[model samples]
Target: MVAQLETPILSSPCRVPYTVEGLLQVFTGSHRSFFTNVMAQALRIAGQGTPVLVVQFLKGGIGQGHEHPVRLGQNLDWIRCDLPRCIDTPQLDEAETKSLRDLWDYTKEVVKAGSYDLVVLDELSLAIKFGVISETEVLELLEQRPRHLDIILTGPEMPKAILDEADQITQIRRSHRP
Candidate 1:
């Protein structure tokens, strides 16, 4: 049976995450290889004992959704959508649309719970651009996120609003191999 998602309620103040200042960081580029660096960084952070959540907004085919998180070293939680293929365009069937929405809702719930010190939203911009996810809801999530939860958003065509709130923005460009 499919697990029903309950309405998210944010009232806990349990974790203070080992951080003084939680900053919004953005990494965007034309190359998908940039994700490798981010993953390495997430692993490093998790190794340091910080809880990290890495959500791949548009990636799937592994049959893993919010309920089945791949835990790496007890600190990092990696999750993706439950769709059969990666989302490339806006068009989606009813089932695919519901799956994507479930992931988003689950992500928001975990973020609200302060379950992770660092959260990575991978390929999120593409979801937003494709109209699978609303940019306004993302903004609301940012505004309501825990004070010490550092978030790193990775994808191309990031919205200006998100860029404006970013404490640091890294834009990658393709270049010939050295």
Candidate 2:
């Protein structure tokens, strides 16, 4: 379900002079949950010609890698691990581990280069929790990103350091269905 905006944003394909210098936001929730609104927001920004990068750390099974990126509206780039299957557990083969590391490295390099105005790191917490990437490195990346870049991180049970660094936090909860 989508949150009702006080005012609807009509996309007439115009450039928006973004006001904020940068923002760090976190969306934490249960495992296997879909962050539809986050994705929607990213698309909306990208549709307006703002650069958006969506990195899915744990999702794979699709054989996606840094070499191949799915571009949307010429402003959004989506990348996933180059693994044979979606990583759901900590146990990974040597090859699977290497692929994840590659994606992480690529993500950092591009982000440090200020390639995108908005970056959505999906399941990044899990990558840290699984020890594929260190939390300290993630914090350093967040700290070192371009000043005007807005970053959104989504996952379950985000590390305290990441949460503390967030400018805003949105926790999703499932309501009881009748």
Which number leads on lDDT? 1
lDDT of each: 0.88, 0.87
Question: Candidate 1 lDDT, tens digit per residue, 1-178?
Answer: 0111234455767634343667788999876668998898899888877889999988989999999999999799999999899888788899888999999999999999999889999998998998888999999999999977889999998999999999989999987897
TM-score versus the correct structure, for each prediction: 0.87, 0.87
For model 2, what is the alpha-carbon lDDT of residue 107?
92
In candidate 2, what are the lDDT values of residues 78-159, reduced to their tens digit? 9999988899999999998999999999999998999888999999888998999999999999999987788999999899
Off by over 4 Å in 1: 1-19, 176-178
Judged by whole-model lDDT over C-alpha atoms, candidate 2 comes out at 0.87
Cα displacement (angstroms), candidate 2, residue 148, comes to 0.4
Question: What C-alpha lDDT does candidate 1 achieve relative to the native structure?
Answer: 0.88
